[model samples]
Target: LVVFLFKQALTWIFGLLVVEKNLISYPYRLFFKKANKANFSFEYFIYPGLCALFSLYYPKNKSNLLKTLHFFISTSVIVIFEIIAVKYTKLIKYKKWTWYWSFITIWITDYVTHAFHKWFFKTKFHE
Candidate 1:
């Protein structure tokens, strides 16, 4: 209900901020002087959207320890897979590794959004 809406709103705000920052600085720097490629690829949107959805469905009673462990494990696993995929196959290149900032940003953004949602929804943090 209220929590869901709050999460959605916060997610939208964070998404906009990321886009603006990329467009104003990162994209220009990556493309112009660096001669690096930059574009609105699928991962640009997918990671953040997945983060938002995960936050929305997070267990309310999960202990803080468990939640933190889950976060690290999940992030590490994804990073490892990406690294392997880039290294072994030509699926994604090394240059694209920097693009993972989107994942990190979304991770932080989702945590903040979850905090706000909890505060507004009167949800209690466990452990």
Candidate 2:
């Protein structure tokens, strides 16, 4: 419960920072610029923010190898979803897939946040 709240807080903070910095426009500017039209919104930013927070709270009760595997699996799943959401659906669109850099930024942020949270909380594993 406490961890969940912490994750939410972190997500909100990052979301706000992205909005303030106008970094959210990077996707549309870099990739979706030549598209028939652009549909940029805060939703795109919020989802990744939440994903980062959730990744940070991933379970840590398995062996080290298992835990690492779980992290990779979890992160990959989120990245895949993001790709699909932005590419196939009207949820978000890009003129070109070169927008991969934006997704990479989100991925790295998620991994870093998860790692930072695990360290700050002293995540423990058990048999």
User: What TM-score fits each model?
Assistant: 0.46, 0.49
Which residue pairs show backbone clashes in model 1?
Answer: none
Clashes of each: 0, 3
lDDT of each residue in 64-101, candidate 1, tens digit only: 88788766655665566656755676544443235466
For candidate 2, which ten residues in a row score worst on lDDT? 35-44
TM-score for predicted model 1 compared with the true structure: 0.46
Clashing pairs in 2: 31-95, 32-95, 56-114
Clashes of 2: 3
Local accuracy of candidate 2 as per-residue lDDT tens digits, 1-127: 4444454555556644554455443344333445422222333454545565566556666688876676566657656776776766555444433345555655566666666666676758655
